[model samples]
Target: MKLHYSPTSPYARKALAVAKHHGLAIELVASNPSQNPAHLLAVNPLCKIPSLETDDGVALNDSPIICEYLDHLGQGPKLFPAPGPARWRALALAALTDGILDAAVPRRGQQAFPMDEGRSAMVGRFQSAMSRTVDALEGVDLSGPLDIGKLGVVVALGYLDFRYAQEPWRPGHPKLEAFYAEQMKNPIFSETAPPPA
Candidate 1:
């Protein structure tokens, strides 16, 4: 499978991590969907990174879908639960994490739109929403092996590195700091680490 990706996209990094952690053989094809390239539109109408192109030429968009698809291919070391409360917990965390990015990614888009006129006040609103999400998730228990949801936190951290480095989110959140430092060590994350520069 070929994963359309940007080096600094957390969503793409998550897909890469899942593949790496499970020892799956997949290829990463760097793409800038933001550029709205013609060829990319054929694979994914949404024009987003982390779209997985199956061997059969099917394209899968969105990170959650990609992650679930990757999990389906894995034999062991699953990131999500089969069925039960644990699954719900992980899913909730994943949702919350994604929500944070949903807001930030756009704010990021606005800030990088090349013209201030293209930015919107709602972009700042979305950024505030992400901040609240970080606060809400700060109390989560992440003292053990990471669940898919826990990875959501790492995804957000990577987003911060990509777009919100000056946000001062970590100094007050020890739980997340400790979790991020340890989680970042997993080859899954380390290998796909974003290029902040």
Candidate 2:
């Protein structure tokens, strides 16, 4: 299998971390994730990073879809819960984290390279969205006895550190900091953790 990705994207990292946790080593087709080539676009309509190329030539897009496929390839612990209320809960949390990340990237893009005033508003909106999302997570259980939802939290916070540590997030949210530290013990988390540029 091959995973098309950029090393810094949290969404791409999610799939990479899952692959590591499962002890799978895929060919890393790292690329400029924002620019889609014709061949890559042929694989994913969105031309998004973290597109998985199955051995048989099937292409899968979106981190969740790719993660699910990776889990199915193994007989080990499932990253997603089996069909039940818990499954949706875990999935929903993952989706929420992804949405927060989606909001943040554009703001970072604008502030780092603003073209107009509208980009500033977009950045502000995304930043507020992230703050609210973090606040909502205040009392959520972050202890992982090895669950997919927990992995979602780890990746989300780690991504913030990777891309926006200058914009400190955990100082006012010690619970989040503590939670992230706990999840950091996993080798995959550390191995895949992005460094500041």
Candidate 3:
């Protein structure tokens, strides 16, 4: 399997971490979407990072889809729970954390442009969404064997730490802070952590 990815992308990091945790043998192909790389464009016209070319010659895009596909091929216990309340709970939490990434990643990219009123409003909205979502995550149960939800939390917090350190999210969210600290000890996170910004 080949994975086209950016090391600093949190979404790509999620898929990479999952593959590592499962001990899957995958080739890492570094790609920059901005350059419109031919290989990536061929597999994914959207030109997204973390596009996976499976052994079956199938192409998969989107981090969640890629992660689920990798989970199916992995030898370890499943990150995605089977049909049940557990599955719903895990999916819900994953959605929340993904929401954080959705808001944050774009906001960070928008920083390259001038901060006009419209852009500033969008940034404010992104900040509000991230703040509210993190607050909601604080009271949730972060304790569990590694699952999609927990994995999402790890990636989401790591992205914030990597890209938004100046904003400091650790003040009142002790549970989240502690959960992230503990999860970081896992090799999936420790080894695949984004480089220092």
Candidate 4:
């Protein structure tokens, strides 16, 4: 399997971490979406990073889908749970974390443009969403084996630290802080961390 990815992409990091955790052999193909790489576009019409090309010529796009695919390829425990209440909870958490990433990624791009009320308003809205999400996460139990939801939250927090250090997200969120700290101890995160921007 080959993974088309940008080193700085948090979404790519999530997929890569899942692959590493499951001990799946995947070739990392460094790709820049900005350049509109023909190879990437061919596989993913959206031209997104973290696209996975399987040995059978099948292509999987989106971080969650790619991670789930990689999880199935190995003998390791599943990050996504089987159908049940646990599955719903995991999926809900993953959705919240991914939504945070969704808002953040575009906001970063908007930063390249001039700062205006429109940009500020958009950023403010995202900040509010993040704040609420973090608050909610603080109350949720992150115990038991690591799952996709936990991985998603950790990666999302990492992305915030990497790109939005000015945003004070850790001051009051002790649980989230501890969760992130514990996850960072894992080599999967430290090894695949994005370079300083």
Candidate 5:
């Protein structure tokens, strides 16, 4: 299997971390989606990073889907829960974390342009969403084996450190901060740390 990823992409980091955790033998193909690379676009019409090409000529796009596929390929404890209340809870938490990235990535992109009232409003909205989401996550239990939800939180916080280090996210959220710090010690995360932009 081959994973098409950008070193700085948090979404790509999620998939890569899952593969690493499961000890999957996958090739990392450095790709820049911004360039509309033919290899990426051919497999994923959305031209997104973190696209996975299976050995059987199958392509999987989207970070969650790619992570799920990798989870199935391994023998470790499941990253995604089997169908049940736990599954729903895990999926919801993962979605909340991914939502933070959804807002943050575009907000970062908008920074390249001159600030306008509209752009400022959008940035403010994204900031508010991320702040509220982190606060909510502070109360959630992060115990038990690592799952998709926990991985999502790890990647989301890492992205903030990578792109929005100046923003005050860790001052009051000690639990979330601690969780992130602990996860950073994992080989999967430490080894896959994003390159400096």
Candidate 6:
């Protein structure tokens, strides 16, 4: 499999971590979506990082979708549970984590431009969403073997730390802080951590 990725992309890191956990042999192809590299565009019209081109020649995009595909081919316990309440919970957690990324990623990009009234309002909204999600995560059961939900949490929190270090998410979210610390020790995370900010 060939993975189009950037070292700094949390989404790419999540996909890479899943592949590594599965012990899959993947060829990493450096791609900068901002530059619209033709190879990346061929796999993902969105020009997104973390796009996977399977050995059979099928192209897949989106971190969750790619992770699920990798999980299906993995040898050990599944990251995604079989259809049941457990699956729903894991998926729900994944959604929440993605929501955090949905806000944070663009918010960070917007910082490159001059801040104005509209940008300020959008930034505030993003911060509020992230804050509420972190608060909600504190009350959830984060203890478990490695799973998609846990992976999402780890990657999401890691992204916050990498890009928003000055605005820490650790304060008042002790459970998440501890959970993240423990998860970071896992090779799946430690090895795939985004290049230092």
Q: Scored by CA lDDT, what does every candidate get?
A: 0.83, 0.80, 0.94, 0.89, 0.91, 0.92
Model 1 off-target regions past 4 Å? 112-120
**TM-score preference between candidates 2 and 6, better one:** 6
As for TM-score, the candidate ahead, 3 or 6, is 3
61: Cα error in model 6, Å: 0.8
Report the number of clashing residue pairs per model. 0, 0, 0, 0, 0, 0
lDDT per residue, candidate 4, 28-73, as tens digits?
Answer: 9999999999989999999999999999999999998998888888
| Best candidate, TM-score | 3
lDDT of 4 at 186: 87
> In candidate 4, which residue ranges exceed 4 Å CA deviation?
none
The pairs that clash in candidate 4 are none
Clashing pairs for predicted structure model 5, backbone only? none
RMSD of each: 2.1, 1.8, 0.7, 1.3, 1.1, 0.9
Candidates by TM-score, descending order: 3, 6, 5, 4, 1, 2
Best by lDDT: 3
Which runs in model 6 stand beyond 4 Å of their true positions?
A: none
**lDDT tens per residue, model 3, 36-137:** 999999999999988999989999999999999999999999999999999999999999999999999999999999999999999999999999999999
Error of 2 at 147 (Å): 2.2
Question: Where is model 5 more than 4 Å wrong at Cα?
Answer: none
Q: Which model is ahead, 2 or 4, in terms of TM-score? A: 4
Per-residue lDDT value at 70 in model 5? 93
